[model samples]
Target: MKKLALYLGLVILMFLTSCSSSKKMSSVMKTYEVETMGVGNDGTYLIKVTDYFRTSDEMVYLDGLKRDAVHCVIYSGIPAGNGSINQPALMNADTKIEGYEQALNEFFEQKEYLNFINSVVNSSKTITRLKDSKEYRISAVISVNKDELRKYLIDKKIIKSLDFIF
Candidate 1:
């Protein structure tokens, strides 16, 4: 009985030591939100995306065009007519407009912007179509990587790399 108790105590002590000595791995995470606007054109819709930077209290403008950043490529496309939307081939001025909105959303949502900068990102996209025309307007807002932006500015001498850790 005494030997059994001793072995049990030893096992408990070993378990306690291992648990206390274990190390936690360090990691990084990013969160984001989005807002959107829609314009109707010939039963179709045009949407734009914009990212939100800091709260209204913080810096109102980022690099340019308010505090949010714009994307250079379109993120998605939807067709028009019959109130239905589809990602059809790019054609006409309306298609060009959609492309711009998509690009802006993509650029701001990039992990490099949010994860590296360690900023909570929010974005929006809206579309509005003319009442009696075949035209639609799209817009978007995106905010991410504020810290990365600051670091880049400080390191103006050298271009800094921006990317998500995970």
Candidate 2:
């Protein structure tokens, strides 16, 4: 009986913690909303992705051993009024676009954040760019292809045709 009570209490505490964390995140985001300049000619969009992580995690990632941090994947596709659009941009681009190489420089030339990481996909070429400010202690590399994004967008009606040419 005592064990059962303890288990219930733990579950309740976990539920409340998760709920409060989400609410706290909302408030933090309100204060630090992403700044979007606009989309590029090839449907590539630029926005700063920010997250509010636990202070402990922030200290570890921002001050510890994470020097060359990889980046996270795209969270949502582009948006239009009254609805969402499949205006997806791949993180990996095989064709480099002018005025877009700034991301690479930006990636290397930034610091003094809770945590900052910029991803570059310049092996073949690149048309998309992204920089992330995470409040969590997570590491990853997200590779994507334009063809795959197009197929998914078309199949899901995010775009009209594969060559819709955003």
Candidate number of the best TM-score: 2
Return the lDDT, model 2, position 6: 100
Cα RMSDs of all predictions? 17.0, 15.2
TM-scores for all predictions? 0.22, 0.24
Tens digit of per-residue lDDT, candidate 2, span 108-157? 34632113323322232211223363344332221223344344434443
Error (Å) of candidate 2 at residue 18 is 18
lDDT (tens digit, per residue) of candidate 1 on 21-49: 98863121112222333333332223333
**Which residue ranges in model 1 land beyond 4 Å of their true spot?**
1-123, 130-135, 158-166
Off by over 4 Å in 2: 1-32, 55-150, 155-166
Q: Rate residue 69 of model 1 by lDDT.
A: 26
